[model samples]
Target: MKKIKVMHIIGRLPVGGAENLLLTIVRNTDRNRFNLIVCCLDKEGQIAEKIRQGGIKLVCLGTTRVRHSYRKIRRLVELLRHEQIDIVHTHLYKADFWGRLVSLLYGVPVICKTEHGDVNSFKNKPFYFKAAEYLCFNKILDRLSDGIIFISEAQKKEFEGKRIKMKNSFLIHNGLDTKRFSSSNKRRSQDRSEKLSKNNIVIGVVARLSDRQKGQSCLLLAMRKIIERYPEAGLLVIGSGEDEGRLRDLSAQLGLDGSVSFLGVRDDIPELLAGMDILVQPSVSEPLGVSILEAMYSGLPVVATNVGGIPEIVRHGETGFLVPPKEPDALADSIIKLIDDPAMAREMGEKGRETVMSGFTGDIYTKTLEDLYVSLLKRKCRNRNYRYADLFEIT
Candidate 1:
């Protein structure tokens, strides 16, 4: 059988959720059945190196500073033609715009774009932010993207609210390498145990410390409240961005001088997650929180903002608790509730881990994506469309 030649175009391969999700797909995809190539519209960051390390082909345009560069488009078009790409799968806005335009021009069989939870794009962000090269081009651009995938149903519904309809839309939840998380937890258990005292509690958050959206300030304020009750508690701020200095200032202003630790971007996330007692996501808007799932895989109870697709995952009183965004009081209260009741927190963490294992593993994510790709190619071929269902029959 001839392998499906897939070319994934993206803004960059930074250590972000969308990049990580794309890497998850790249690493987990059945290589024998799918020949993969990556094209980054901007400079290749850390994850791009990891993709190349996997022995896959990759290219970085590095034309971010060159505004309206036709050379970048020409290069992409040439690569698509040279590779005979069957599908062009794109992630992020810049890539979506160029990928769709170039794929249409090159007569690629299909164009698929992953919608990585921009619930705040239209409604929450400032008008200027929305105006700056935004792709809410709605139905017009949707026509070119043969398949539009929403990482969460909340994101799809947000788009639907705008009456934007497109062909070949689907919902595919992101997944984690639960086995890797499980093994890492076992190995790091003894090490993390040494840091834990009988009265100590560690609250953690793994998110980019951006100026907007992530709501780290809210978590810091909540930590001040947590300290009043559990004085031994400390907050672990993982990842990094432009807001680090401002967040650090806020930490000092709140008299949480030593209570919060900003570790910045670290490669050993699985090991770090092991050291956490409870995970909190205070994002004012999140299509879905990948860190929540990662924490769940590591057996940590989650406390997240109730907005977006989070309600679908947290399940209120079941796996974890959800609070309204920006309310430091409510956020602190939820965290305090977990801290006060150790047995309940453990039970919730156990339940959360079970949910991840049952539904959101790498195997399930890979198969669903592979099936989607096969179906898209089959639909085009059924012009004698091939049936992805048939592939399942023989395998």
Candidate 2:
């Protein structure tokens, strides 16, 4: 059988939730049945290098500005033509606009776009920028694309709230390599046990340090409250972003200089997660909390805001506690509850790990994606009255 060619276009391969999800897809995809290609609209970042090392084909169009995108569109079209791409999947705003436009014009058999952000994604953006995105995403792409992949129910409902109908949409939850975390935890358990004191509790958060989107400031405030009770507790802020300076200043101002450690962008996340006692996500708006899942896979209880798809994953009292967003008192209370009862915390962590293992693994995620691709392609072929063998010969 001729393999189906799938090209995924994205703005960049930065270390992010969406980027990491894309990497998972690239690595676990069934190479025997599908040919995967990644196209970056901007310069290739770290994730792209990983793709290249894995022997996957990657195209980097080094066009930095929006105006340069037009010239690169022709290059994109040429590449699409040369590769005879059967499917075009896009991610992020830039890729959605340009990839869909080029693929639609070039008459690609299957085109899909995954909406990674929730409705609150544009709350801080200016009216003009928001309006432009609405026009492109809702008005154009929603109507033309073969299918829309929503990573969370919250994201799907957000789009539906705008009364934008997505008939061919699919709700596919994001997944990660649970075995990687499990193995890493096993390898580091003895070392982690020796390095840390039994009395000291470590609260960890993994998100871009942006207060506007991630709401790390709320976590800082909560940490202040947490310290009054658990003096031995320390918070680990694991990520880098534009808001680092302000967050660092806030940490000092809150008298949390000794209590908080701002560890910048890390490649050793699985190992780091092993050292954490509890994971907290204080995002004011989160589409899906990938870090929460990661911590769960590492057998750490999560205390996250009850916003977006977080509620879907966190079972209030089962896996972990879900508090209201930006409420420092509530956030602190939940974390304190966990700290006060180690047995409960351990039970929650065990249940959370079971949740990820049962429903959320990279293999399950990739297989679902591949099945979606095949189903969509088969429908297209049926409509065109073309056989599977004839699909490869289509000019």
Candidate 3:
């Protein structure tokens, strides 16, 4: 059987949930069935080298200026034609915009877009921005794209609430290599030397310092409240972004500078998870948290906001506590609960690991995606005509 040629298009290779999810799918997919290549629409970042080093083909179009989309699109269309790509799967916003546009012109057999989040993703956008979602995404691209994948059912429902009727979409929960986190500590010698004091409880968050969405400001407030009750409790913030300066300033203002450590963009996430007693995802809206999964798999209790897909994963009492979004007091209270009862926290962490092992693993994720590919291809073979009712039954 001839292997199906598939190309994954993304804006960049930055350390993000969508980028990491793409890498995981590429790493786990069966090569015998699919010839996979990654096309970075914008520039490459930290993970690009990792993808290239893995012996998979990677193409960077070097799109810098706003006007370069035309040139990039032309180059991409030419590449897709030359490679005879059967499927063009795009992740994130920029890629979804340009990649799908190019694929439509090039006439690829299958075009799929994965929604990392839902309509809530554009909550605080300007008037024109909301118009783009209503017109560009809902009107034009919804019909053009072959299959739309939602990371969780909550995400799908949220998208539907925007009065957009998706023809071909499905819910495929993200997965990871559970074994990676389950392994013994792989923290560098320097990282291994650093440990929370005997009387101290370490709470950690692994997310970018973004301007919005990630409620890092609220987290700082929560930390301020936490430090007063449990002076022995400390917070570690991993990952860097544009909002770091502001967040750092907020930490100083809140007097949490002493207890909170902002360790920016570490590649060793599992190692970081090992150093912490509990993981906190204080995002105002999370599609799904890979860090939370990694923490749970690492046998660490989680305290995440009850928003978007988070409730689907963190089963409140079972794995971790889910507090209402933007509530500093509630967030602080949950973290304090885990800090006070180490035994209960440990038990929750163990159960969290079982959840990942049973339902979320790299193998399960790859297989589910493979099944989707086969099903789509079969549909294409059976119906040569363009119109199909719904592309996803991911239930």
Which has the greatest lDDT?
2
Each prediction's TM-score against the native?
Answer: 0.91, 0.93, 0.91
Candidate 2 structure quality by residue, lDDT tens digits, 1-395: 57899999998988889888888888899888889999999988878888887789999987747667678888999999999899999987778778888899998989998888876566554465478676665457768889899999988888888757779889899988664565767444334333334547889999988888799999999998899988889999999999999999999999999999999988788988988888999998888878998988887888999988898888889989999888999999999898877777877888888898888888998899999998888888878775444745322
Q: Model 1, residue 364: displacement in angstroms?
A: 0.9
For model 2, state the Cα shift of residue 388 in Å.
6.8
Which runs in model 3 stand beyond 4 Å of their true positions?
122-131, 185-197, 385-395
Superpose all Cα atoms of candidate 2 onto the true structure and report the RMSD in Å to 1 decimal.
2.7
Deviation in angstroms for 174 in model 2? Answer: 0.3
Model 1, range 62-110, lDDT digits (tens) per residue? 7744455588878888898788788899988677767787788777877
RMSD of each: 3.4, 2.7, 4.4
lDDT of 2 at 354: 84
What lDDT would each prediction earn against the true structure? 0.81, 0.85, 0.81
Instruction: Evaluate residue 124 in candidate 3 and report its C-alpha lDDT on the 0 to 100 scale.
Output: 56
The TM-score obtained by model 2 is 0.93
Task: Please estimate how well model 1 matches the true structure, expressed as its whole-model Cα lDDT.
Answer: 0.81
Off by over 4 Å in 2: 123-131, 134-138, 182-197, 386-395
